[model samples]
Target: MLDLVVLVSGGGTNLQAIIDAIDNGTITNARIRAVISNNQNAYALERARRHGIEAVCVSPKEYADRELFNQAFLDTVDAYQPGLIVLAGFLVVIPPAMIQKYEKKIINIHPSLIPSFCGTGYYGLKVHEAALTRGVKITGATVHYVDEGTDTGPILLQKAVEVREGDTPQELQRRVMEEAEWVILPEAIQLIANGRKEA
Candidate 1:
């Protein structure tokens, strides 16, 4: 079984999807040990709480600086001893400390097909906006290992979503989430849990 610690910000649709997958047996031999968030108001915390999973908020604003906050966050995650750390809409730039400790153990769900509308300065709806601006007919979501660089890690699972005619960025974003991100994130975790994913 994969012990998971999921980190999130905002509404946590992806987090909720993982939880649902666990409940529905779509993701086998995997359990969420905890959910952590930098935003105290994040609904992700509530989702975790609702599922009886430990929920923690380590707000960066409470710390002296970015490094201190990163340490605190890392400590919190380490306490859970997770086999996989899932980043589901987590907004913070990953700290070197956590990256070094977790290495390939951390995975992230990006909203774009990656190598396309990814890397630094591309996040949230901006990724979808870039795809629309570039006039790409196909854009999708990618589940990848979290490396030091942004979205440059070896890809695990990707499901493409067609960008229909006159599709707005928001529409494409929503479609990607529904058609891709929510689906692949859990599947990748399951694959990892089942010893199917490569190192």
Candidate 2:
């Protein structure tokens, strides 16, 4: 079975989805090894602990530099020997070294369609706000490989959600997250796991 290290910074809805998938055999060959968060108060950590999985926090404020933070993050994740690194709502900019080390093994679920409202400063509610402001008719979530660039990795799977004329950012985010949890994340993980088997 593949082991996953999930990183999150807020409410762990995506993390919860992964756990549910594992429990229900949707992700047959995987188990969550650990969950890491930058924020001590993040609910994701609590969820991990509830599931008897190791949950840890590595605050960037504790490190003097970005490289140091990245090294520390790498060390923390390394202890679990994770086959895959899943970024749910993790808000940190990963350094090049860690990205190179993990390469295509790291995957992220972005709140918006790629090559659009994605990049630095485009996360959480901001992504939905941008899409709504642009008067887009369709917006959705993307699951992609994580690279050095901001959300500019190879796409694995994407699911679209229609944007209603009177929809607020919060409403759009709600629908997008629902699609993310039920469709995008599970398909992405299955793609990687199946690819590993092929290799």
Candidate 3:
């Protein structure tokens, strides 16, 4: 079984979906060990608590430097001994040490089909706004392995949603989130677990 540690920074709709999938037997042979967030008030923590999972907050503000913050983050994650790390909507840039520690075990869900509208400045509403302004007929979500670079990892899965002519950013975001919560997260985790077993 894969022991998962989910990291998030905002409303944890995707996190909740993962919990539901595990509870409902959609993704069997796996378990969520903990949920950690950088934001103290993130609703993701509440979701984790609701499921009787350990929830922790490791704010960067408490540390003097990025290295120290990342070290603490690594310690927190290591305490759970997670076999897989899932970034639901985490907003921080993880340090190289942490990346090296987890390597291919870390994964992220992007709001847009990557290689088109994804990078440092593109997140949340920004991605949707860019897609709407560009008048793209198709916009979607991507699940990828997390490398040191910003959203520049090997793609695992992607699902496109048709963009209507007059679709607002909120409209596009809603559709993208639906695809993310319902399909991408579970499938990506399952793929990663299976790949690890094969390796």
Candidate 4:
């Protein structure tokens, strides 16, 4: 089985999608080993618990410095021996050491198609707002391997969602999650899982 360690920051809609996909057999030969969150009160923890998956929190606030927190985070993740690490709306910038250790084994689901409204200071509704501000009609979501640079990893899957007229950022975000993020994230996971099995 392909073991996954999913990281989340806020409400875990993407995490929910993964759980549902696994339960429904859309993503086979894989199971979530644990769900880790930076926020102690993240609802994602509850979601993981509901599914009987191990849930943990390794907050930066608990540590004295970023270095300490990063080590704790890395140690926590490594303990799970995850085959794949999935960033499902995880807002924290990944630690460089962890990235180096995991390499292409880590992946993220970005809200935008990437290379636009991505990189620094672009996340969540901000991406949708920027797309609206730029008047782009074709905004979407991307699933990519996690690299050292932000959203600069090799692309795995992308699905476009229409930016409708008079669509608010919240509305656009919702649609993108439903149409693109939800679909592609699970698909990407399955692709990776199947590839490992084949190999």
- Please give each candidate's TM-score: 0.98, 0.95, 0.95, 0.98
TM-score computed on alpha carbons, candidate 3 = 0.95
- RMSD in Å for all candidates: 0.9, 1.6, 1.5, 1.4
For model 4, residues 1-199, the per-residue Cα lDDT tens digits are 8999999999999999999999999999899999999998999999999999999999999999999999999999999999999999999989999999998899999989887789988998899999999999899999999889989998888899999999999999999999999999999999999994221
Instruction: Specify the poorest-scoring 10-residue window by lDDT in model 4.
Output: 190-199
Model 4 earns a TM-score of 0.98
For candidate 1, lDDT tens digit of each residue in 126-175? 99889988899999999999989989999999999999999988889999
CA lDDT of 135 in candidate 4?
Answer: 100
Number of the predicted model whose lDDT against the real structure is largest? 4
Q: Give Cα distance to truth, residue 66, candidate 1, Å.
A: 1.3
Per-residue lDDT of model 3, residues 83-150, tens digit only: 88999999999878878988888888998888989998999999999998888898899988889899
Query: For model 4, what is the error of residue 14's alpha carbon versus the real structure, in angstroms, after optimal superposition?
Result: 0.3
Model 1 stretches astray by more than 4 angstroms: none
The C-alpha stretches of model 2 lying farther than 4 A from their native spots are: 196-199
- Model 1 steric clash pairs: none
lDDT of each: 0.92, 0.87, 0.87, 0.94
